[model samples]
Target chain A: MSSPSRQPLLEVRNLRVEFFGRRGRLLALDDVSFHIDPGEVLGVVGESGAGKSLTGASIIGLLEPPGRISGGEILLEGKRIDNLPYEELRRIRGRQIGAIFQDPLTSLNPLYRVGEQIVETIRTHLPMSEQQARKRGIELLQEVGIPSAAERFDHYPHQFSGGMRQRVVIALALCAEPKLIIADEPTTALDVSIQAQIITLLKRLCRDHGTAVMLVTHDMGVIAETADRVAVMYAGRIAEIGPVQDVVKRARHPYTHGLMGAIPEMGADIDKLTQIEGAMPRLNSIPPGCAFNPRCPSAFDRCREEKPYLLPVERSQVACWLYDETGARREAAHG
Target chain B: MIAFILRRLAQAVLVMLTVAFIAFAMFNFVGDPINNMVGQDTSLQDREALRQSLGLNDPLVLRFGRFVANAAQGEFGVSFRLAEPVSRLILNALPATMELAIVAALLAVIFGVMLGVYTGLYPNRWLSRFFLTISLIGVSLPTFLIGILLILVFAVLLGLLPSFGRGEVVRIGWWSTGFLTWSGIKALILPSITLGLFQMTLIMRLVRSEMLEVMRTDYIKFARARGLTNRAINFGHALKNTLVPVITITGLQLGAIIAFAIITETVFQWPGMGLLFIQSVQFADIPVMAAYLILVAVIFVVINLIVDLLYFAVDPRLRIDGGRSGH
Candidate 1:
């Protein structure tokens, strides 16, 4: 067994996901690679069709029909779990790697009481007495900041407000004390005020438990606030990734720059926010060569002719030829 | 909930009264029950005297009022043909018909739900397709035809069971070994299958469609994300969500089953209320037919009320106003 201190909780490499559409097979995620060290929070940000959610679903082994991982290796605690049998995959899910979904109302079973759901998830992986499970369930509920956890355990999902239900969902996810948690837009369904509360709760609880999280969202503000490291995906591939501050301050990829520019700055005097020049290309009509080449403002002949690999750019990785220092230097000196 | 029940009960009473009035009007339209019961050879004086004695000579309004009063007191006037109380005859036949209908419904619901769950979970698979084909055949085939086919297969060809009629009514208590015996069950099989086949098929298709819809819900997907096994996701999450529609269809079909019982009873020769109903119609036993019609109408109303109540029980959201649509 690997020591918890040295080993990363989850590692994903060269992951490719595809969906069979009427036109042809559409690639949702292409050559996606990332790792979540123990207790790390890695935020994945992208446009609607950029496959951030697909990556999270693939990692949790919950990809639905018509969408499947075509090529990938998902390692959990140094064990390859990409091709594990569904039964084994289920055992690992919730117990080894918990998940919190975007919709709070749906993430928890409506028919069951919040407390009962938590207890059930706890007992699913642990051999414990019902009383013990019940106690632990209450503790988790209280830990998640739900008031009167004992009494509220009997309440159904509909009885709770949207924020409270999300707290319950988070509690249910944490019941098994899994090493990793994949939260897919966990706060997107809540109001703006409640969104901050939930994010704070998630950060606090995960930090206390030393649980790594792969937070998938389109909200850059959420990434800036919560993510330790950030990965920016564009058209099924990671366009850039690095430390949150590095990526936010010195974003190398044009897509990342466009995303940052689109956000409204607090002190800026600009009359209107800067929007990207064009919409993200449709899945079926993705441009040839580099998927982002058409969208990139600084595209050159080489960018149009060959797809650029994710090369190191300063403190971050950028998949654009403009950031290729050696090639830039040679062109500059010769010209 | 109490208000709903009271409202439903009031509606049920109105429906029963309407059914009674219709039955009476139909009887009157068919001409004198006395003339139909007696022969043409009877003297005119005797016919007039018989009509007066039977209260047929009274005005239409007076006769209707009298009929309603008598019905309330359980005196469905003496059967014109049998010369017995219509109430007594209907009471005697009711147990047999109720027995058949109840057992058939039970079997249908059990088998239908099982088949529906299986097919919904594995749609387009061979087993599901096979069940789908079988259910289609069941839906298309009439109850009497299915009954005759079952008798031909189980009775005539194999001699595995009796062709018709309830076996000896052993003098044991109602809940005795005789009722529990394989012999009693063997006698009931043909009638039950005949009565149940159509309902079974109807329910299976309804349940399958409902379940297929429920399986696509976000909650089911969330359950899978929670690491629930496929069986748990299908049965625990999807099946429960599908029950409201199934319950509604089952309740509606119960009314149809009552109507079907008449034909099934005639085919099988089981001395149920349905058979009694046909015999009364042929012999112009007006009282018995009216009583039977009223009883069936009451059963329909009661079943619908129960289904409405069940909606609240199955889905908590329905307890609040406008929650049924949410589910």
Candidate 2:
């Protein structure tokens, strides 16, 4: 758990992202903020268009064209990193932070061998010879649970199966010993059996290296299994963020509660799980008040009128009208 | 991998034989070699004697068989008017055209790739518009027009270059190169630039589209996130991946450049295989004409082989099939 006495490894404050698209400007991310402590995994769970991947990309400085970080500060170890020059930023990227993309095939360059790709990344951040980098690359592959890592060093990405390719990608991300890694849906493309293996490897690596990870996925199962703390997002905004156990087991926001309720438990015999009312609003047509208010069953008079700010409620931070002073006092009076 | 190459080699041989038979048949369809060899005043016996010695009197199939046999031994018989071996004649004129095509292709690749990569990385409306306009002009204009326009500007109007003939030939070993002389280089510029422009535009478009596509791939985003420098990401990663398609396009374009060099050669009046081909065609020099077609077919086959090899080198997926798993 992140304490007040220790500075968090990475902090994103009031992060706002926009896209000047063909249909006019759409706010992709609105005041999204979170923090990942050292050696902690922060799972960002949301729907397909919930901006979970976008947040990871924004943090990793890989937001593609049309989408740009409009406002906010990304701080790494208390140093402002959002506005660094390209060269300086690039240095920070390979040295300080690494990225694992959703699709392993897309992450690995087909022309080069997997070992070569890992070696290139290692050499880019660290001052080492080719042989040294290669040795480290093999070590990384082995650490990532790749079978026969030494012999597989010269094998191309296409030569490896989908699961093996993802393992190679993991090795590539860890080559530089980065302080933080942004893994966006790292196991989505793998087999059901392989997914667990990959998740275990990622967890073990993070623990071994004491690396902070921003694990973005729509799979709440993966989130519960891997993340220390979790951030639930809806319509590009963080609906709730707290310890994984707290957010998953004892959800604060309406969206988070609905999300946790939807997950099917093994022994429970309930046929129809609790379902939310409506879908998360489109980025272009996000409701003015709370983004999830349309689907929230507890929406009140103030929930329709004004956007609820993220406020402290115990250890978790939630952005919903129900948790506010007026809503709480009203609930007390009603009871 | 060895099996792949062996299979391609066998296919090349089959293609060469097919092209040779087609060339032989096409040549026979043209005017008689006897008419081109002997003057109008020559007697019937003399014509018969000349046809007999040249094996022209034989049946078309027998002559084709004989021609095939001779060609197999690197002999394409003698030219009708020139009275020189067709192989020697083609060999003599090959260098200038080759030099021209090589220069043009190289320039096309360098300029095209650089410009395409630049625009691909930093796509803007104005730059794309500029590329579109250039592509329109380059794609719309035929080779001859581009050649003539270049000549009219640099040769006729400016008087800076020689319009006709391959400058002085400097024989080096078995090969005679035109680019060894200063005037040869000067003569080469207009034609190479003229020939290269169309291909350059083709290459530029290919590289641009491939680069644009590759830049959006997951690897590129991952590379950027890894904090690789722009140079490393664009040139090292993006450009390298884009080259798989570009290489194939360039290889095919190289064959096209050689084929189109005939028109380019005639327009420039350059003494190359293309010039020999036109002159041989006009005079009904069957051997030279047949040899030229066979030569071109061989060039294409060789290029195909090279491209296949390169494909294997660049892409590992191509080798995944017919292989066992694991290292």
Predicted candidate 1 versus true structure: per-residue lDDT over B193-278, tens digit per residue: 88988999888988898888887776776676667777777777788888988999999887778756998888889888899889
Best by DockQ: 2
Expressed as tens digits, the lDDT of each residue in A259-321 for candidate 2 is 889888999999899888778788889988888877788887677778777888899999987
lDDT of 2 at A238: 93
lDDT per residue as tens, model 1, A103-180: 997666677667777776777789998899999998888999988778787777887888988888898788888889
**What docking grade applies to model 2?**
medium
Q: Model 2, B1-112: lDDT tens per residue? A: 8898899999998898898898788666667767766789999999989888877778888988887888888798788778888878988888877998999899898888
Number of clashes recorded per candidate:
0, 0
Cα-based RMSD of candidate 2 = 2.9
DockQ of 1: 0.39
- Rate residue A221 of model 2 by lDDT: 95
Query: Interface RMSD of every candidate?
Result: 5.4, 2.6
Minimum summed lDDT over a 10-residue window in model 1 chain B is located at: B169-178
